[model samples]
Target chain A: MSLVFDMALVAGLIALALHVVVTRDGRGAILAFMAFGLLLGIGWARLASVDVALTEAAIGGGLTGMLLLRAQAHLVRHAAHPAALPTDRRRWLVPALSCGLVTLALAAVVLAFPRPAPSLAHQAVASLEATGLGNPVTAVLLAYRAIDTLLEKIVLILALVGVWSLSRDAAWGGASQLRPAIIPEPLVFLARVMPPFGVLIAVYQVWVGADLPGGTFQAGTILAAMALLVMLAGLRLAPQTQSRALRLMLAGGPALFVLVGFLGVAVAQGFLSYPEAIAKPLIVGIEAALTLSIAGTLALLVAGPPDRAPEP
Target chain B: MSAIALTSASLFGLCGAALVGIGLFCILTHPDLLRRIIGFNILGAGIFLVFGAVARRGAAMGLSGDPVPQAMVITGIVVAFAATALAIALLRRLASLTGSATLEAATPPRSET
Candidate 1:
């Protein structure tokens, strides 16, 4: 029964995916892509990685949908009418063949690979308990090799900053004033039901990660999803100016990381090395800050610059 | 069960690859910039599928599963989203400045588009 269900879901994904690819209207394609993300979230859950499942649902399905819809609204107003894409163009033949060959080669290589075995991931899991987190992934994220995750957060912030700077002088600020978008009644009903429980689930995922498949990333994703739902329903408007609190929240993760790292230097010999005596508290604090920061960064990505709302 | 799981997984993987190929075709053929962006998103989804399959394959081992790749993929997805947003902003700006609805066709000069 489970296998049958999995097959059904995968089939649905492939069908939607094909539909999305074939659609001439970019807006319709974007909506299909969002649906695919939700299918992917389900795919992950069925595969048993609850953390990934949650994150996929939140970020991949939820936040991404919001961003695409917002961008599509602008593009539709500005772009040409939908027409069948030109497929008779012969000049693409060589590049197309080359890309096809490359893709086939990659698929063959993956098919030939042996089953995975224990290594870095296993090692991380083995030593995870020492990190004062219940979830091995969380331990891997914020403790074992937290430096990588820290830099990643910085990357997200930098990307957003780059977007803001590039469009800063342009007519990007009128989306907030665009004609009030209508939210379908069904979606409004669903949004109201999902968020409260989603909040609880997101928090539960964070709190029990010491031995389970949940963590700050998954939790932040859920928070981002809630924000996305609100945005989609027009319950919230993209701010014309970012609030002071939003600014602090945006900088919170990096700031907290630096603050905690320096404190570690004061107490220990190296940066970010929590003293054995207070490791749990330090982990909890850093994780909480990271979660908030991630949530803010994701929300902003979907919201874009409140300053650049394109006039409807 | 494992055999069926592996097969279905392989099938999805193949579908993903096919999607990537079609998306590339769309990118190469479509003159509309927005359609090209859609192509890129399709391409990314294909790559994401490969990563998901890798994670499932890892489950076969009696290990606690590697969080590293999954973490990396999650991080990559977010970063990709941010990059896409930036691209959309730049593309929109480009569209407004030039008043050209078909930047893809104009760029390569008798090339792909």
Candidate 2:
């Protein structure tokens, strides 16, 4: 029964992906990709990676889809002219054939894998007692692989900078205009009603993440979505790129994270090491700060580079 | 390939391979930068799913998948997203400057105001 469900989910995932690639209408393809992301999330769940499934759904399906859709809307409304695609029959065949070859090669590789696959599961769980994080995945992220997480956070901040720098000189240090020319009634209502619940769910996820499937990425995505909802509905202004507080919020999590890592070198085992006595509290505190910063960064990312010129 | 296996890991592994093919096709052939960005994301998802299948094969210690791979996938998903946002921003800027969304050189240039 479960295999049947997995088969069905994979089938849907493949079909949606095909539709996204082959569709002529740009908007329709994006919508299909969103469905594909959500289905892939379920596929992850079946593999017993619920935390990944949540990230796939929230960031993969929800946030990325919103960003693409917003970009589509912006391009459609402001393009100097409709850019027509060159339809070349010969151009299509090479990519199609090459990609098919790649797929067949990869499929063969997967099928040839040896039985009794090698893994780090035993080591992960065995070392879990000291970190005090019941969730092994969380341990890998915040404990065993702290440097990667810290660097990833820095990468995110840099990406935001790259996007912001794309703005015109006059619009530098300004805010993107996210409000629609006319707001819809339903959007306004949902923006007003949804955030309270979204905040509660995000908080719960961060708190339980040390012991369960939920964690900072999923919670941050949720909070970002709620903040986006309010911004899109014109209920709240998007932050100006020049705002001092906004810059601080964007950098706070990683700053605190680096501070702890250095402190570890002096007081604990080494860089990013936690003293066995207080590892849990230290990691949890890091996650809490990260959650808010991630939320702000993602929300602003989807909001795109600022367009409104700074006040004279 | 020696007679195809029916394990869930193998099955999803095959699914992921096909997705990579489809996404690569889109990226290589699709003219619209935005659509290509979508293609890039689909390709990322495929690669992650393949890794997920590998993690699943390592299930033990009361965990369904290896924590290491799962953590890596989570991180990959977020990084992929940040990269996508950057790509979209660049695409929009290209459209604003060139007044065209595609890179093909044959499209006739427009007169500047």
Residue range with the least summed lDDT across 10 consecutive positions in model 1 chain A: A171-180
Candidate 1 structure quality by residue, lDDT tens digits, B9-93: 5555555666677667667766666667767776776776666666655653364345666666666677677777777767765
Error of 2 at A52 (Å): 0.1
lDDT of 2 by residue, B11-70 (tens): 898898988898898888876778889999988998998898889999998889888999
Interface RMSD of each: 3.8, 3.0
lDDT of 2 by residue, A165-198 (tens): 9999999999999999999999999999999999
Ten-residue stretch with the least lDDT total in model 1 chain B: B104-113
lDDT of 1 by residue, A46-146 (tens): 65556777777777677776667776676557654434555655756775797688678767755755654323656765665567666656666677677
For lDDT, the strongest prediction is 2
Give model 2's TM-score versus the native structure: 0.96
Residue A300 in candidate 1, Cα distance off native in Å: 1.9
